[model samples]
Target: MSKVWMRTRGWVRRARPLVSLALVLAVLAACAPGPGSERADIKIGVQGPITGQWALEGLGFRNAVALLADEVNAQGGPLGDGRSIVLVEGDDRGDADEARRVAERLIAEGVIAVVGAYNSDATAASAPLYDEAGIIQITPSSTATDLTQHGYSRFFRVCYLDDRQGLFVASLMATELHVKRAALVHDGSLYARGLADWTQRYLQEQGIEVVYFGAVTPGQRDFTPVIQALDESGAEAVYFTAYWREAGLLVRQMREMGVDDVRFLAGDAVNNPEFAQIAGAEAAAGSLISTFPLPRDLQSPEAVAFSSAYEARYGEAPQSIYTLMAADGFRLLVDAMKETGSVDPADLAAHLHAIQDYPGISGPIEGYDEKGDRIGAGHVVYVVTEEGDFELFKP
Candidate 1:
């Protein structure tokens, strides 16, 4: 070997162990708090329904975030800070009470941030708990109009909310579907109620007759009452603002009852394979849904890699592309942690406040405004095919 190459190889051999020892010493120095080193590991918390009715969505969030945590770890964690990421996951079981409890527990666990509570009610219920404890909250699927209202300092979302989704559905019905009349059905949950109310108001303002606005209890397997009401009201479309579990059952019952002519428009909650599972191919077929960016339509190589990894791990396609948004939520929290260089919610909230056009795996992200709403105007809609594939539709 050349003399220069020999010298370089000798230098590498001499420096490797010293560098490793220096890194270990620096980690120890981080724990002692000095001006010389950074933290060893930062704990990031994730809260969502790991069990109960929406476990599929909750599990999807968990799986996606886990994948991201691994990726973050592989990159040496938070850049420029010399800190590694350690993810602590909590299961809320899709219950409001459980969400609050999990929020409190995650805060007490010394976590810097939390990922989600998939439903609006759960997010709203747990926001104050996280805010008081200085834990930043980021969710992908909670879309109630007032989610970020009342100045929940740490609350943020990764996708469009009810007001925008409601308008998107209304416009799709009027301009695209050419439907002049409609009915609304919800699961009596806050998320469903908000979307349903907004859809009715927008349709009425647009000169469309909203003949029925109604609710159903969650876990109800029968929909004869609602379907009969819609049929009598002469609605051209029945807008469903409920989760897939209930939406699927309702649609199946409606079809069985011969109410097949009316177009079925659904909310983001129904944008998953579970809907097809519950209602079967024909019952879920021809149904339209509003949701986050489509996974199949993602243009980024990183996004494609995530989708492939998700499919490989789960033995099926991702339930919804919103999983990517949820993953982005956790990523933003980690980014915010790096920006503030501390886990304090107030500092991180300030960092979040200044974020503009953060290019994430899902798409562009804008932090909350004065009203705590994300400043953006893009949410997609998709239609379910009879063969159980989701067809991307322009929102």
Candidate 2:
């Protein structure tokens, strides 16, 4: 019995090694990519302030992207190679530090491209990470001029730069509005300061006197002191380079202080409906806003279809042009993917650089210049009607 037990133990040990080897082989076979195996979905990151102060804009962006993704997936996606596109949302909360963390998270999720970071500071903060990861980033609304100056090939923007917007506002004030004195107020944000600086430079070059150039701390509800100073400056026009919330509050405060004679003008950041809502219809009326073409303003068949589809899906019209701009960015990326027949970041970047006359929902994207800045980007001024609706300014 002892001899038989020893023989059985030796046999069992030898079979144990064979069984372990077989199990390892089976696991490898199951994990290996082959026929009948599921293919990984291509990931795209949508980073924005989904929960914080800029939630409206961020939600609009996410909704637009989601709508487009649904349409594409229904049609078999961009590749037509059996892999669907999956969107990963990263809520940066409009903060620079949070944007960096979001970027890292997106990179870890294996996103090949990113569609946002609405705030200029947030975009600037996260751009390096995307570039380092060889992920393509296309911002829909970040207009800070220095963003494209970073020499990051993978970074692109569908919107115009602050310089272009500044020049446009300066030209409008000098050539059309015929203003001699202008007061410049900014919220001290990176976007606001850069826009204020460029607007100041252009206004000075255009020979308009800058009566009062100052910075206002964001989130300060009472702008009484600034309104008083602005009224004392005797400026004909006031250009507020900041987001919609502060612009609305400032304008409302100005009207409350009986500073009605001064023209209130805001940059593209104030294009949201909340601007007028916060300022009240009477106070918001007649204010000028420099912005890209709004969704309601687009007349093209494609634009009309997009607007209808967006409204049908979301149950309301897109509030800001940034939403449409974000959709355009997604379209451009998909176009590049289709043109190259490859999801390789380098290939997509190259295709984007070479793209010409690509029709976008916003307008004709004349393609990116050497610095990835959109060429032939222009801005138009909109005037708030008595009903608090934006209309293209005729004069």
Candidate 3:
């Protein structure tokens, strides 16, 4: 062997044990959880209807949060110091009392933040609890007009407000659908009343005749009475401002009562697969809905990637807009946490208010206004196809 070869061999022999020791130590480090790992796992409460009619939306939010937790933690989570997310599930069952209970429980659990209450009525019911506790509560859905009106600094929502949705629907009715005479029906709930009232005002302002205005006791089995009123009033269209469960029943009842020629329009709450499930694909066809941005309308690369990842992880496509908004809500919280380097709701609230043009999978949030309403948030128009899926309305 040459002199150079002999020297190289000696160096390799001397370094071998040290290199082996380093490899063993690295493996041990990888196997053992780090010292700060336990402290770093931040607990966030996720509240929604896990067992009621709106359970699908709640479950979707849970799945989206789980997916995001996994993804964020893989990159070292919000703090980027080996921190991770730990979600505490709160099932509100879509009831006001249950929602209040859930909110109180989450606050008692010492969670840093909360995401929940898919329906606006439930959200409004629970908002006081979170606000009193000073816990940052970001809802993935819930679009009642007055959600942000109470001036709760910790309360925020990713979806557009009911006023925007109602306005858009009224415009669609006047200019596109050319609705002249209509009937308005709403469940006697805060959400339904606010949305329906706004739409009714806008419709009348546009010179559309509101032939019948009525309210229904939600969870009632029969909507035939309301359908008969619409028929008698000779309404060219019927607008229902409520959740899918009631909307589905009302639509089906209207069809059953031979109110076929009158077009049906609804709000964001009906933008779910359960709507079709309850109304039947045949019954749901040709209904127009006002809602947040649909997955098909998302053109951002982040949105496209998120949709693909969500499908791959869940083994199915997302059926509700809440899933995307839930993910965005979580992202917004985490981003605030990172920016402020604190889990304090007050700090999160400040950061949230300051965020501008946050690129989210749902859509870019232009930040919160003085009342905490998301600036630049708007609604889209969709029509249910024969197959009972929402597609962008051409008209």
TM-score of 1: 0.86
lDDT of each: 0.78, 0.88, 0.82
Highest TM-score scorer: 2
Candidate 3 global lDDT: 0.82
Cα displacement (angstroms), candidate 1, residue 346, comes to: 2.8
**Cα lDDT tens digits for candidate 2, 67-135:** 888888777878888667778889999999999999999997778899998999999999999998899
Residue 163: error of model 2 in Å? 0.3
Cα lDDT tens digits, model 1, 51-165, are 8877877887888887777767667676645566666778888788888888887776667678888888888888888877767788888889877766777778887778888
User: How many pairs of residues collide in each model?
Assistant: 0, 0, 0
lDDT value, candidate 1, whole model: 0.78
Give the range of the ten consecutive residues with the poorest summed lDDT in model 2: 1-10
Q: RMSD to native for every prediction?
A: 8.5, 9.5, 10.9
Off by over 4 Å in 1: 1-40, 79-82, 309-317
Error of 3 at 108 (Å): 1.3
